[model samples]
Target: MAVAYVYGAESRDISAPYSIWKVVGSLLFIIAFIPLTLWLVKKFQLAQMKLSQSEIKVVSVQSLGTKEKLMLVEVEGERMLLGVTSQSINHLKSFSSNARTFATMMDEASSPETPSSTEEKKL
Candidate 1:
């Protein structure tokens, strides 16, 4: 009979201390994870920003892809680009020309040399 009970014992009480500990542990895990989850969400939402500094100044914003959540922002004179991965921001060729037409810019205000051919005296 003892051997039979050992093999086919009634289910243990789920309301026991071990069960209570499991519930508490699960709750603690959820609570602890909340802030980290929120932080990652916030990080996901931060837009990549770039500024151009020229007569045709521009600013642009782009969303990082799920696989490309890490962005590289580059500013060269009045040109800026955002890339999944690149040697320079120059890779960012998509600019809101509507915005660029109005906000001549860059982060460091570097003025690239104007094309010498375009400097002819006005008639």
Candidate 2:
């Protein structure tokens, strides 16, 4: 009976430290897992963005009113101007292949035009 009681006490003492270690290891694993999972998700999202980079691009956007906007989008090398409202999106214009880019148009608008050589000769 005494040997049996000693065996039980020894087993309990051995298991107590191991059980505490197990709980601590589990808690540490959980703490590490959350950030690791978040990091992996962010990496995958970045990879997807890189893969779809050139498919469709938004060149510019303008807000007309509270719920209305104008969006210039480029898709497959074609540029389109779209008017967006709370209710619907309407296609305002489709640029031709030879049409100038938005930056060129802005520059031309901002710069003062000078008379040509022919105009000067005529004058």
Candidate 3:
């Protein structure tokens, strides 16, 4: 029916109704276009963000309230405690990489239960 309609339209037959192929083609274009456009947008966004230059990495974030939170951020080799609110973000304190805070984090990452450790605990 759609092929017949298209053939009639191409032949300038005014009596023929609209083609189903036109509607299907439009739907297919929209489906393909949306995902392709979205992927391009995401690729563009990732390209714009320089991960290497972003030295301040968020180690952890804790919510205190609906609009207030605490964040532990590592800037260069130093770690800092941050107070975050809806209006602003403030640095509460800064500590060196050798600080107890960082040592504790390292200890947690390489705990006894981790598979890589060959040493067994003596009872």
Candidate 4:
């Protein structure tokens, strides 16, 4: 009688329903989750990139040592030469954006002086 009872219990457990829908749903959820996570990561990365965009532009850089550098940057129509290191950034010089170029100065120097201007200078 005890053997029959044990056999009956085992048969009841084996006869339990196996739902195919549950297995299919879990697989679909797993498949959909990967792309969703990747999309969210990409969206946040784009937002961070947009936030970092600014008017300040780096025109040039020269490495001085292992950790020291010289950087030329332009911001708000002013150009700045800076010394940069791990500890601090120092301003070396600044240039006005509206300043004339060397080429223009050379052209002015090479041009012939008008007679009226020369006469005015003598007077």
- Best TM-score among the predictions, by candidate number: 2
- For model 3, what is the error of residue 95's alpha carbon versus the real structure, in angstroms, after optimal superposition? 2.7
User: After superposition on all CA atoms, what RMSD does each candidate show versus the true structure?
Assistant: 12.9, 7.4, 9.2, 12.4
Cα lDDT of model 3 by residue, 2-50, tens digit = 9998887787654333466677889999999999999999988888775
Model 1 lDDT per residue over 5-115, tens place: 765544454346678899999999999899999988776665322232335333445466544433333334434454653333435454443334323566334466446
> What C-alpha lDDT does candidate 4 achieve relative to the native structure?
0.86
Lowest summed-lDDT stretch of 10 residues in model 4?
A: 13-22
Instruction: Evaluate candidate 3 by giving its C-alpha RMSD to the native, one decimal.
Output: 9.2
TM for candidate 1 is 0.30
Better of 3 and 4 by lDDT: 4
User: How many clashes in each candidate?
Assistant: 7, 0, 0, 0
Each candidate structure's TM-score, on Cα atoms with residue i matched to residue i, is 0.30, 0.48, 0.46, 0.39
Tens digits of lDDT, candidate 2, 1-123? 999999999999999999999999999999999999999999999898888857688879999999999999988878899999999999999996569987898998878556785588788
- What C-alpha lDDT do the candidate models reach, one value each? 0.53, 0.91, 0.82, 0.86
29 Cα displacement, candidate 3 (Å): 2.5
Better of 1 and 2 by lDDT: 2
| Candidate 2 residue pairs in backbone clash | none
Which tens-of-lDDT digit does each residue in 1-123 have in candidate 4?
999999999887665534466677789999999999999999999898779967897878999999999998889999898999999999998877786654695898879799998999999
